[model samples]
Every structure is written in structure tokens, then in C-alpha cells.
Target chain A: MTERADCRASTVSYAAGMLREQLLSPTPVDLRAFLMRALRPRDCLVQVGGLAEVSYHGRAASTAEVGSYLVMIKRDGSLQIHTPKGVKPMNWQPKTDEITAVLEEEQCVLLASRRSPVELVRVTFLEVQMAQALELNEEAGFLLTGSEAQMQETLAAHPELIEPGLRVLNRELLVESGGIDLYAQDAQGRFVVVELKRGRATQDAVSQLGRYVASVQRVVGTGVVRGILAAPSITGPARKELEGRGLEFVEVNALPLVEKRTSQPSLF
Target chain B: MTERADCRASTVSYAAGMLREQLLSPTPVDLRAFLMRALRPRDCLVQVGGLAEVSYHGRAASTAEVGSYLVMIKRDGSLQIHTPKGVKPMNWQPKTDEITAVLEEEQCVLLASRRSPVELVRVTFLEVQMAQALELNEEAGFLLTGSEAQMQETLAAHPELIEPGLRVLNRELLVESGGIDLYAQDAQGRFVVVELKRGRATQDAVSQLGRYVASVQRVVGTGVVRGILAAPSITGPARKELEGRGLEFVEVNALPLVEKRTSQPSLF
Candidate 1:
């Protein structure tokens, strides 16, 4: 009996260990106190699974039916409501919006309001299941420096990299649908709609190029309007789509143009 | 000339005001030094527009084509790559991974590595057009407490709230596709599949309910399986879909089930 009890105790601790590092309560009595302690000035994601009624008053008034909710609060005071699927949030308020949480006798309510747009969102929790606070570390990932304009400039300076006979005509040429990255002429004098990507080109990029080609063809009439997708690389799916669409793909390497300043004295 | 200069000056400051409140640099000389200064322990979002190549060596070896990239660094050391559109990132590294940034004479490189599965990601920036960092403030949003399990349990205990003669037969009944939240028999003795949403029901939720009903009907063979979507409220589009599909919608209010203990002594 003692051995069985010891085994059970160890299992409980093991389970606790998995969650205890990030969570404070196995079960909390005061929901407000828990939130006050858990919520920090950084990013926090809260998942609620119970009855929740969300009411929003904005351009047009609407209220969400009571259901489970996932709430994400960015460090900049912006908040968004998410369902299980889809990239866009079911509902959201901008970073400038203000939010406050109030704990009543047996319910916890959160109120978010925006001034300029005059929007209000009120979320009421009928039952408390789990509440966890996580501190978001922003600098722990990659920071990139560069822009598409720089890439475009670099590519334009070296049109030979695209094809031997390709001659550049205009950059950011205005069309009906959108701006074409580059307008060029091929060796055969066929108008080429060049779509430049700073990274691996995806299927969407190919489709975008197709749209540009179609738009240009509509305006250019009889002259064969060819489409060319230029990037460092292209994905397999994107390549397949490009082939199917009879579009040409060219690999353009973005080499550093400026000479390294090795002669400079090390400040660090 | 003075008026022209004043207009130009105001325009410059106006553009500066638009970016300066969140970003420190009008233009930075050294990308690494700027990142070292801009990257804090909190959440920061960095967008770069130039030639960038991302290489990943992990369970599967792959590389991203050189292109403009949006790198988001969470406070937890996790990072994600975002393209111009799409809800999900092109690639991502989890918090458990380690990241390092190296500044070369003419290039800025970011390396992220993980051990357990053995993964490595290298992002090389050929040119930096724009790099801006914004500090995240987490406490500005709402914090919620609740769980779906509790809502399910409550509704199961009070089946009468759903309908007059509705009786809950089983909770989480396993079907071919997935588990039904609640299976019940209505007043007409017809089998009913109850899909409970703790918040506002969207079109996706209704579709999910429809799937459950279809799966139940396929299994029950002849007994008239009906789907009932129960939530605090339903969206206009969701209601329209529900009506078109001939499904019933019920609003279930999430009221506090327990009374408040006001007599207790306050402890802060």
C-alpha cells in the first residue's frame, strides 16, 4: 500500500512538473488576483474553455455567442480573438485600443475599447477552467535588415543576370491591376513582365506574375507578352505551377555590391 | 526659399513622427549595431526589404529563396518568417532553439539551431533597405479564465436548458471523423447531435456541427439524426448558413453557476 501510494505521489509530481514551471495554480480561488499576478507588461496569450459571451459595438453592433475563446494580447495593447482555424482573427482591436479586466462575484469580464473608431468589446466568462500567464521574449529570434527596393536596384543594375539579351525598360511600371516590378524586352523584342522576389518564389508569386502578364497582354495586344519570375530560388510547388502556366523562372543571386571596409579601426 | 524650406522641414518631421515614436533610427549605418541596440528581451517585430536567403538543415534539408523577409521574434526565443500575405509563416523556429546573429564586412547573417531533432537555419541579408523595431506591451489587453470542459460539463448537467425534452445520452461520443460533444434524444425520440460553442458560433463551427450530424446519420442508419448548434450567440453569416442547411440554432447564456463569497476577509 505504501509503495502504491509512493508511485501515485511521484506521478502527481511528474504531472505537476510539466505545468508548474509556467503555471502557478492547480486551481485558483480568486480569479482576479491570479490574473493580476500572472499578467505582465509583455505579451500574454490566454485560452479559455467554457461559456464566454463577447459583445462588440463598432460600425455596426454585434455580439458573439457564448463559446470557448482564445485571446492574444500583444505587448502594444492590441488584442485579437482566434478560432481553431483560419489565419485572420475572428475579431480584433488595434494596438491603440484600451482593455481592462474586472472580476465580479462569480464571473470575470474583460472590456476593450477604442476611441477614434469608437469600438467596444466586452467578453464575459461564465466559468473559469485554466488561466496561465507567459512572458514573451521578443529578441530571442532573428532580425533581418534589407528591403525590396534595394533588391530591385541591385537586379536592375545587372540585367545580364536575368538573361543574356534581356534589356531593362522601366521599374515599377504602373498598370491597371498593380505596379509591375520590372518591364523589359527579351531578345525577340517580346515584352517581358518581370516579377522579382528577394527570396524563394512561391505559387502566389507566380500567380501574381500571371496577373501582371495578363494585364500587360490586354494592353500590348498582338506582341507576345512573356512572363518571367526572378528570385534567388523557387519552391518545388511554385516551380510546378510556373511550368504548368508556361512561365519562365530565372535564379538571381543577391551578392553584396559594396566593398568591405576592412581598413576601418575596430570600435568594439 | 524660406517658405519652401519650412514646408520641406515640416514634411520631413511629419514622416519622422510617423516612424520615430516606435523606431529609434531614421537611418542606421551598421545593421548589427542597430540590431544589438534595438533587440530587447521583450517582443519585437523586424521587417527587412532586400536580398535575403534562409537555409534550414534539419529533419529535412531545405532552403528558402533569397527575397525580402519579415522576421518576428517572440520573447520566448521563437521566431517566424512572414511573407506579404497568408495567415501562417513561411517558416518558423520554436523557443527551445538557439539563435545567433553575426555581422560581416558586407553582410548580416542570423543563425538559429535546435538540438533534439537537429535543425539549423541560416538567414543572410545581402542588403538592408529598412529595419525597424517596435517594443510590445502585453498588459494592454484582456486576460480570460475558463475551459471548454467546464462548459460541456455544465450543459450536460442541465440538458433542459438546451430544449424542453432534450436528454443528453453521452458526452464526447466517438464517431468516424471525430468525437461529438454531446449526443442526445429529443422530445420526438429522434437522435440529436449537440455541438456546444462557449462563444459566438462562426460558419466554421456550424460546418463542423454539420459534419458531426452527417457522421452520426451514417452510423445510426435510419433514426433521423438532427444537428443543433448551441452557443451564446451566432454570427449573421453563420446563422444564414445554419438556416440554409436546415439546422437549429439555440442561444445558451453563460451565467455564473456558483455564488460569490463576499463574507470572506480581503487579503492582498
Candidate 2:
């Protein structure tokens, strides 16, 4: 990394950045100590990528098959579990009440939990690959301006705007009935079906949202789903039908935003 | 990495494993060549972890904020994107029709896509972290034994057992109404609500599934989710109610399994 810079442009973000010397090959005790101290500061974004088995319990119970994954702990009390593929996080707790790590029976075990509704995400790292706590900016909320895609980006990035502790599992999710505007889990861990209408929502908007809800209801089988139509305004007819369908409505203004994120430009 | 092993247990999965060197510091041209060749072999699992901007289209449309992520492409025509935290992949396309890489604007751009239903996952690598194609055993599908947790673990690993091309995003996921047995995406790109029954799926099983479905339906506003009740057998009443709710049923056997996977034992 210290090699003299050549004419070629660097594609490496951390060009000369080396993972702390000791971190290159961290021991279990090292990992536990690093995780504890890293979580205490709550300043740097702590990331550990390696082999692990993860399990979650609370709203919906789940246990993942053994594999490698990247575990990120953010200062916002959010712990995101990410697999090597996809834009959606496999399992996540937007904000945790407590995060702790311990070396149990020779292996490093990390537990992140929240109390309100009582949710827990537990991960056991069998092998540590790279455990680096990087300085990442999460408080600089982004202002994205564009069409429905941009709105989805802004809202997805800041789910709190819709509801505190709300997490959008996936955006532009395709389901049988049609493409859903947003697929999310609520604060209480309920599946939230969101239909984002950039302008004033009227007419068929209610029915459109209803169809998507029905499709999910039939498929989700036994899971409660909440349908929400988010827009600046709603028509009386749409509002009336929405109530009959038991769907909720939230007002969202399509404010002109000044883009601030260093996001990837649209693929032409 | 060249260091000799000492008394300390090695935590690195690939301790002496170098990232094919040129891949260590890959240029746009080098990355394209590396990715294309790695994917073509369809033997070694191609993993590229670095700083990149990713977006997904088809079955759903999503654009992620600019950041770093790990991109892994498997021989199974699957592309997984991993964030720093969580067991679930941020975005994924299981069993794609084709995988390709290109150099655009002096940047390494990789695409993994499927023609059927036409889904696509595009990743623009702003910086390549580690691009290594390692030989991973996928055919050695696991055999897990135990109780309900094992059942879920088995299904999550071999989602093909439930249905081909079905990807179980997360297991034991907690939702509002109750804990979902499995959260998966169907081959057709729709959200699939799955309830696993290790024993006879009868009696109030239908009602239980119904509750979970309703929760998800209410939450997923405009998406079609297919509800599936999987178990060994079902009573006539349960079957009747399942259809009445438009929920489909699949039969699964809880046969005594012989544990074979190099799986980690339950953390005491």
C-alpha cells in the first residue's frame, strides 16, 4: 500500500488504509475486547465479516443456516445483518437497547437486543475475518430529489420519518399482484405495506393499494399486514374505501430536495 | 498472510490465501477479466468485497445510498449483496440466467441477471476490496437434525426443498402478529409467506397461519404475497380453511435426520 503512486487512478477507498496491525489476525479474546470497547464509544461503525451462525427472536422467530456474513453495528443503536448479495438486509434491528459481546466456550458470541417490544438478534462468530471499526457518517441524513425511486431512497434511508424504529426491508419489491412501493416492518415488528404516491393520492389509488394488500394477505397467511397510502393528500372516496379495507393513510409531501448523498448515478 | 502458524488458533478462513494477487489490487480492466473468468468456471465461489454502489430491479425496484458492500456471485447463478450487519442479504437474485462484467467509465461494473421473469442485479464497483474466487462446496448440501430450529435451518439452506428458485431471506423472523417461520421470495419475484409445521398441520394450525397472513397483508400494502402452509399432513377442516383464505398448502416430512453438516453446536 505504501508503494509509490503511479499514473493509474486508485479504485481503492482505503488506499493506504491498513486494518489495525493486530486486527489483521484477531484472536477470539481480541475480538471480544475489540467489540466491547468499539460498542461503548458508539462513534465508529463497527464491522465484522466472517463465518457465523445467526438467530433472531421477537416478532417473528428465525435462525439462519451457517455461513459467512458481514455484521455492522452503527452508532444509532442499529445492528444490520448483511449477506453477500442483495440490497435488503437479511435480518436487522433498527435500534437496540443493549449490545454486548462475550467469548463463550471458546467462540465469540454477540447479542443485540431491544426492550420495548422485546426483540433479540444473536450472532456467534466462529471465525473472524476482518473486524474494523470505521468512521462512517450516519447522522448526515440524505436529501434525495427525483421521482418515486428517489422518494423511496430518502424514506428508506430514514424510516423514522414514517414511524420510529420502522425498517423498510426492501424497496420496489415485486409481488404477484404488482410491484410494491415499499415493503417494511413496523416498530412492533408487523409487516407494513406502503404505497408511496408522490402527488395527491386520489381515485384508484385506494383500490390499487388494496389489491397489493390482498395479495400479501393471502400469501403471508396468518401474518398481520398493515397497508398505508402515503401521499400529500387523499380523496374522500379513496379515504372511505381505505377504511373499509382497514388500510391506514399517512400524509407525505413531495418536497423539492437538494441531493447531498454521494449516491451512484442512474445506470444509463 | 505468509506468516507461519503459531500456537494461537487461526481465525482467518483463508489465512495464507491470497486474492489471486492481481485481484488484490485490480484495475477496471483487471476486475472485468477477473470477474468474467471467475464466474465462467462456475466452480469456485466468486466473492468481491469492497466499496461499491448497488441497485436492484425486477420483482422490485430499489436504489441504495452510496456506500460500501460485499458482492458475492455463486456458481448457482446467484448474486448476493452483503452489508456490514445482519444474516440477510441486502439484495439478491437467486439462479440468474446470466452473469456479466464490464468496464464502464473506467469503473468495474458487474451484472448478474435472469431472463425468466427478467430480474436483474447491477453493481457498480467504485472500489474493489478483495476479489477472490475460492472453491466452495455447494453440492455438499447439509443434513441438519434436531427440533423446530433444525427444521428451519434445513429449509433455509435448501430452499429448493420448498420450491425451486425460492430464497429464504430470513428464518425465525419476528413480526407484529407473531413470529414468521420463514420469509422468502418466490421465483416469480413475489413475497411468499411460509409457515412450517414439523408435525401434522391441522386443528387450529389454519387459524394460526391466518393470523400471520393477516398481519403481513395489512403491512405489505400493494404487494401480492402467496401464503403457504407446509407440513406433513393436514386435516380436512384445516385444508378447507386454508383454501378459503386463499392460502396454499405444501406437505413436508419431519423425518429423523442424520446430522452431517460441519455445523456449530448449540451455544450453551
Candidate 3:
């Protein structure tokens, strides 16, 4: 590899290390790009916010939804839910690019892709929303409602969804690139990047989001790429300012939930 | 000095250094204990949802104003409008407790108490608020109107109001003990404390303020101290969270120009 490529790889590795530290905490890694290399083939978006949709390659594919279940990898790398839901462990590694396609083909079905076998798990998005709502309230010990065994059952079944989101995000936002937040595709074949704010949205937050928007827009036409600020509720002044600047605000509470599939048998 | 006192002082000095670095960035500080120590003498109350209020020490005596002005000391030690503003200048040393008492009793009216013989200028609070407001909007080249110069001129003229507000703040909140922000009583004896928000009030921002409040409450009783977030319009989940906690929020269009008067001017 060229010196520049090596440098770039090192930088990515460094970022991945930092991210892993943030998630894993005490479990510090010795490798340079542990996350990038390990999670690879699976593209990961770290700390992304203001994303409207995720695109695959050059196409703005509808973001994949496994019912209402929204999975988020926290800053600490540990999985958490704003709602009460169990995340099951699975063995398959779905090809990142094909995960979206698999979700597209079935209302709730599994598919085998070049990357790995994919399974569509039955879950609800409201669970995630509920978890977020509880987070807003700062309640302690908000646990998952389903048993760990059930979550494991789901994870054992639908392993494809986890890495694909990252892959789709990588293609749309030019993953492995240095920048802020995560990248994805919007509805109109545009890149949609998101900047999350758990606190009050300040000018600094807005500007940070604005930077990500600009960066993504440069690659995807400005019109194709849009910014979505995901927050519990924006303050009046912050809302007034960002909305005035034409940034779309998607209140997570107001976000539509993909219908959960109950009758569909579990792939497990 | 007692061993405990010696240890505490060392910790204070250490904390001051850490604060200088953290507050210098646009990123707001996110510690409760640190804020409590930095804004000494004043009490702080951390409410549910991480909302905080920094109560002025002397507010128990006054009740007309909306609340204390959240002010910050810039890294240079100059006062700013945000918390964890920065470090104080190296040469700066706050007055001792004894001096504070003598000065407070004198109501800072006599020209002899103006600690430094700097020129006096008068500045309208509205303009200062405006400057802060614009800066928070990410507007470039934002300057605090010649308020500092104006304050110099005002001090030169009235000289009597040199420490007009000195009595308003409690003696405990003064810099005598190496505090970061100085909360002095204004001429009217109404409690006013400077609150600093390095950036805008996000959830982290509110958390910082919550720490400030918790610190203040430890000294002053509740219901006496009113608070003014005094930033550009606060927005996002932080706003709702702050409001939900009952801390009064004030959007100042400008900041008050504070002049360095040599001696406290006395109308007498």
C-alpha cells in the first residue's frame, strides 16, 4: 500500500480504537484499527446523527427496518435499549450491502447473501422509542422486557441486520473516510447523515451537524443529501434557528415505527 | 493550615487547571463536583433529570430580580457568558475574605475599594446579551460591543457606583478563595451571579448548570435564588429538561459591560 494509504489506514485504525474504548470501556484494545478491521466487510458508522435514510452504493435505498426494532450501538460499544427489548446473538455474517436487499424482499423473511446468511427477526420499533423516552426521563435500571434467552434466540436467528446497517452507511457516506457522525441514504437517492444530541441543541451542535451535512453533500448532490437532527425535543430557540436554516427535525418520538411481525414464525 | 485545608487547596488548584482546559473548548463541561467547587460560596442544586441551579449566597436577602446571571470566566480569566469559560490570568488573585467583608460593608461605594484603578465604563446589558446571542448562532466576527470601553467611561463618570452591585452577591461567592467566577452584589443589593455557558445549553450544558445549582443550594435556601440561563435561546431536549426542573431561563440580547474600577465608589 502507498504511504498515504497506510497513513489513512492507521488513522482509521486509531479512530476505531477510540470508538472501541468509548464502548467497551475497561476492555482496551492493543491493535491499531481493531474495529475497522474486525467489523469490516461490515461498515460501521460511529456516533451518527441527523440521518434521514441510508443509501446503498450510489442508490438511495430505503433504510432497512426489522419491524419496530431499532438497534443502537452505544458510545460504550455495549448494546442498550431505550425500551424494553432483548437483542439475541446470532452466528451468521450477512454481506453488508445485501442486508438492505434482504429486508426489502421480505415483510419478515430471511435470505442467504454472499456475505452471510441473513434472518429477519420479529420486533417492534416502539420498544426502541420507549427506551429513548425513558432515557429522557433519566430513569435508572430500565431493563429489557423480553428474557435474555428470547433475545439470544432472535440474535441466533437474524444475524444479518447488525452489520448491514453499517455497510449501507459506509457506501452512502463513503465509509472509512474521516469525518463526524454516521452516513446513510435518503429517499431521493441522496445521502442522509444524522447527528445525535442527547442534550439541548446549541449553536455548536447545530454547526457540528451542519459540517457533517456539508461533507456528505459534497459527495452526494446537496439536494440528495439532507441532515436530520434526532433529539427528544428541540428547545424553542434551537428549533427556531435550525428549522429556519432548513434542516429537517425528526423528533424521535414522532418517528414512525415499522410494524412488528407477530404471526411470522421466528427464524430461530 | 490544617492538613485537610492544605489538601483541599491543592485540589482546588488542580481543579482550576483542569477547568481551564475543559472550559476553553466550545464543548461544555459535564461535571457536577467541579462546577460546585469552581463557583464557590454560591450553592448548587442538582434536580431530577440532571437539571441544576447555582444559587447566589446573598440572594436570601433580595427577591426582585428573575435570578442570578449565569456567567463564565474565559480561559484568560476574563468574564464570559458561559460556564467553564476558562482559566483566570496568571497574575490574577482574588481578594481575601477579610477584604471582601470590609468592601461589602462599604457597599463598594467609596472610590478606595475599587481594588484596581482601571478606567470605568458603562455598558448596557442588552447589547452584551445581543453579542452572546449572535455568537451562539455561529455568527462569525461577533464582538461584545465596546461595552468594556463603555464600562470604563461609566466608571469614570459615576465612580460612585464602582461596585454598585457588590452587595447583591454574597461574600462567599467572591473570588477571595480562588474561585473561578465572581458573583458580587450589584448596587441595589439584588443577588446577581454571572453564569457562563461555553457553548450553548445542551443536555450536558444543563447538567453543568445543574451542578452549579446544587452547589449554590448548599449555601442559600431554595425559593430565594432566581436563575437566568442567560444564553442565546436554549433549545433541544436540554431546554425542556431545564424548564422541567424550574430554573428560570432568560435570553439576554446583550451583556452588561463590567468596568474595573480602582476603588469602590460610594454615593455617600
Candidate 4:
């Protein structure tokens, strides 16, 4: 019989309960243990404690590999531990203070401090393959760039369409080495950074873009850096406030290549 | 000629800046303006008042269908209208005090007394589309009962797997009215409602599932209603915390119809 969507949902819930039971039972698997099980053994684990550290074969490695281990921390006392795969389970069990101490002694220093009393500790494997699969190739970089040369070429060809004194800069350096949507210079020689947003825009993106601008100003001098964003859209008021901050607002026609099919395939 | 990644990035940045300048220049045709010009005759105009409302040609149903609008209440107690799509030039400024008074007259209240003098208002289109779509499936009771039957059949074999009392009931009852995801029950007579998650797992899922539970409980009894989620997989800790509250968690196994693609597409 064709498995109906409701049936699929219920069965999935049942499977989930089974998994939960397996995880929360007395012989609970901690977040690290769960990760060791889900990810390839070679996949390194990093714990960003007071400082960042890597763990391998149950031993803390002296050095950390580039993007080797996934970092997880509970923002509040929520104590969330997101693994490369997703959330993992913590070997949390109801134990008296004495038993807890004994177990802590056995587990490791990481498990010793119950900062938030480990309300729940889970380690779900993240789809790390996606991160691994993400290749910063010429296509991604070129698309990510708000370069001057490229803009110049377009402007040169479409001179009648664009204005004069617009200078385009490529891969404009920001303080932190994180992905920037785009960075450019204005006619007045002031820098204008444009961050292109495709998916659901987060406060983090705006805040981070602000940081990039701040960083650039810190390096180049104050009042030199400005910010802008080009997306198919923005939520209520974001565009205005972003513009109000002296960040220019420019709307671009979404390139045809930025389509949904690049992400998921659907049956027609 | 090979396009250096840096070079491409620079080109993109430059293009973005040039585009921004062109859009802001004295008489430039920008995308925002182009869309506005095309849609204006449809009674659509960028709203500058606090409670932004726009009209469209087809049906000016809700606020979301209108052109995006941003209103800023500057420190000088003046209101600024940044309708980038308006026929008026960007620099063709209007009287600030007059506009502010007009906006205030239009019930344009500031976002906060002093904290934020400005707020951006956006017209959302999805809500209208969703409302219209729901109209198509008008037989609410029949649809709900049909969905319940499908859920019951799928969980019949696994009835004993979940809590002892869970079972499907009420042809007229529904788990969710939005109709975006599926829902069902467990063996314990508990109403186990399942939600299909498409995005990456975040604590937000828990809040949303909580809402689903509340909604289902409102229709059913709170004592009998339980919430569960079926995604590709949930992280260990998330699953644990959710389960700790008696909520079920499930992981889905996606397979191809051909069966041959199964091995390659497996999500283990």
C-alpha cells in the first residue's frame, strides 16, 4: 500500500521515540560519544572551550586542523550542542550528587563542569558532507564578488546606461576573513560594501556586514567604509534603516542563475 | 582568458557599486522603480506612513501585496519618505516637517517613543496566497477525516511501538489548519501531532512544535495531545530534550521510486 503522508509522519514519530529512548536511557551516550558514532572516524571534533581545542581518538589534539571539528556551545543555559550532523544526545541521567561526581570523574574534564546542569546533552550528526562539498570555486567566488574590474567591464559596455566616477573594487578586504557578499568604492572614493542575500535574511547577516564595514574603517580610516545590500527582497523596514545608516540601497534584477533548482530537485 | 577568483570578486563588487550609483542618479531606471512604475497604475504605491498599506490591480486584499515601503522618523522630529521606487527623484526631497505631520495625521506612530525613531514596513504577499490557496480545499471536515484515515492506516502495524494509548480518531478533527505539514496519533490514546521540517534544526523548531501541540490540544484535549517532528533527522540533544517532555522524534529515510537510486540517495 502507498504510505500516506500521515502514516509516514506517525511512523517517523515512532522511530524518533525509539531513537530518543535509546539515547536517554541510563546508559546514555554523551554528545561527544554520539558524534564519534555518527561521523566518519577521521572527521575531527573541536571543542571551543575557553579556547578552541580539537579532540581525536578520545584524546585532545595539540593542534587543530582547519575546520576539523565542529564547535557547539549552549548560548544561554539551554546548553545546546549542535554537531556537524545536527543536535546530538548527552548521556544525561537522573543521578544524585554523589553518582554524578563519580560519573564526571570517569567521563572527562569536559563533562565535569555542569555549567547549566546539562539539562539535556544531545549530539546529532550535522550533514557535514555539505560543508565538505562546499567548494569555494571560481563560480562561487565570482558570484560572491562585488568587484570593480567586472563592474567596469559591464559599465564600459553599457556606458550609456551607467553614470561616471563609479569605481568598482574586487575582493575588497574586510577585517575578518569571512564570506562577504560584495564590496565596492563610490565616485567620491568612499567604500561601499554590498552584501547579496538570497535566502532568509538573518540579523546576523546585517550585524556581520556592519562588522565588516567597521573593520574596513578601522584599517583604512573612519568614514571611508559604507555598506549596501542587494537581494530580491528584505523584510519590513530593514531596507530603510540600513539605508538610513548612510549605507546606500540599490536593487538589482536577480540573475537567472540564482534559481531554486540549484538546491533541491522535485518531481514534475 | 582565465578569470581569477579575486578578479571576479572585484568585478562583482564594482558592478554592485556602479549599479547603486545608477539607481540613485538624477534620472536612472532602477529595478525597484521599474517594478513600481509597472505596478503603480494598479493602485500600488509605496506607503510612507507608520501603518503601511498598498493597493494592487488584481485585488488589494492585504498589506503584503503592496510595493515595499520604508518610513523614518528622524531625530529632528521630521518624517522621511524613502520610496526608492517612486517617480520622484531620490534627491528630489520633500518637506520633512510636512511629510512627518501628514504621516502622523495618517496614524503613523513611531516604532518606540525614543529607542527607535524609524521602522520599515513591508507588504507580505505569501499570507494572501496562502489564504487563497486554502479556499480551494474548502471541505474542511472531509479533508481532516481523510487525513486521519491515511494516518491511521500507516501507523496500524506500529500501533504498539509508541505510547500504549495512542490511536487515530475523529474524521472531522484536524492537527493543523495551515496544511503545510502532516500530523497523526500514537498508541497511548495520545494525539501525537507530527510536523514536517524543511530547514536546518534550530531551537525554533521546538517553539513551533509547541504551537502545533497547543493548537491540536485546543481542538482535542490538552491531556491527550502530544507533539512530534519528522525530518531527515534531529540532533541528539534536541531529540532528547523533546523526548524528555514526552514528545516523539523521528528520522525519515528518503528513497527513489526506481529503488536503484536508493543506495546513492540514502540519508544515513
Q: Give fnat of each prediction, in order.
A: 0.00, 0.01, 0.00, 0.00
Per-residue lDDT of model 2, residues A1-268, tens digit only: 3221220121222323212112433567878888887789776567676677888766555677677666777666788766654444566898888898988889888998888757788998876655666543322112223466767777888877777888899887887656888899998888888998876776467756766787788889998999989887888756865787799989876553435446766543
Query: Could you tell me the TM-score of candidate 4?
Result: 0.23
lDDT of 3 by residue, A1-268 (tens): 2432222222211221111221111011212133233333332322111101211111111122222222232222222111111112111121222221112222211221222222222121111111110011111221122233332233223322222222225422332222444455544545666655543455545555655675566665547666666544677655654675577665432212335569765222
Per-residue lDDT for A10-123 in model 4, tens only?
210111100111111112224334433322232221222111122211111112222212222211111222112111211222211111111122331222123223221222
Model 4 misplacement above 4 A = A1-166, A176-180, A200-204, A222-224, A253-255, A258-267, B1-268
> Cα RMSDs of all predictions?
18.2, 15.5, 31.5, 28.3
lDDT of 4 by residue, B187-214 (tens): 5445666654532344345545655676
TM-score of each: 0.38, 0.45, 0.21, 0.23
For residues B136-203, could you state the per-residue lDDT of candidate 2 as single tens digits?
33121223234567677778888888888999987777765568888899999888888988767863
* DockQ of all candidate complexes: 0.02, 0.08, 0.01, 0.01
What is the TM-score of chain A, computed separately for every candidate?
0.53, 0.52, 0.30, 0.36
* Cα-based lDDT at residue A173, candidate 1: 96
- Which candidate tops lDDT? 2
Model 4 chain A weakest lDDT span, ten residues long: A133-142
Overall local distance difference test of candidate 3: 0.30
Winner of 2 and 3 under TM-score: 2
Worst 10 residues of 2 chain B by lDDT: B2-11
* Best of the candidates, TM-score: 2
On residues A1-268, what C-alpha lDDT tens digit does candidate 1 reach at each position? Answer: 3432232222111111111112211222344555454444444333233346676665434566665454545445566654332334456776435666776556677677888767777777664433443322222233332345666787688787888888999999987556799899988899999998876788668767876887898899988999999887999867876887799999875434335459875322
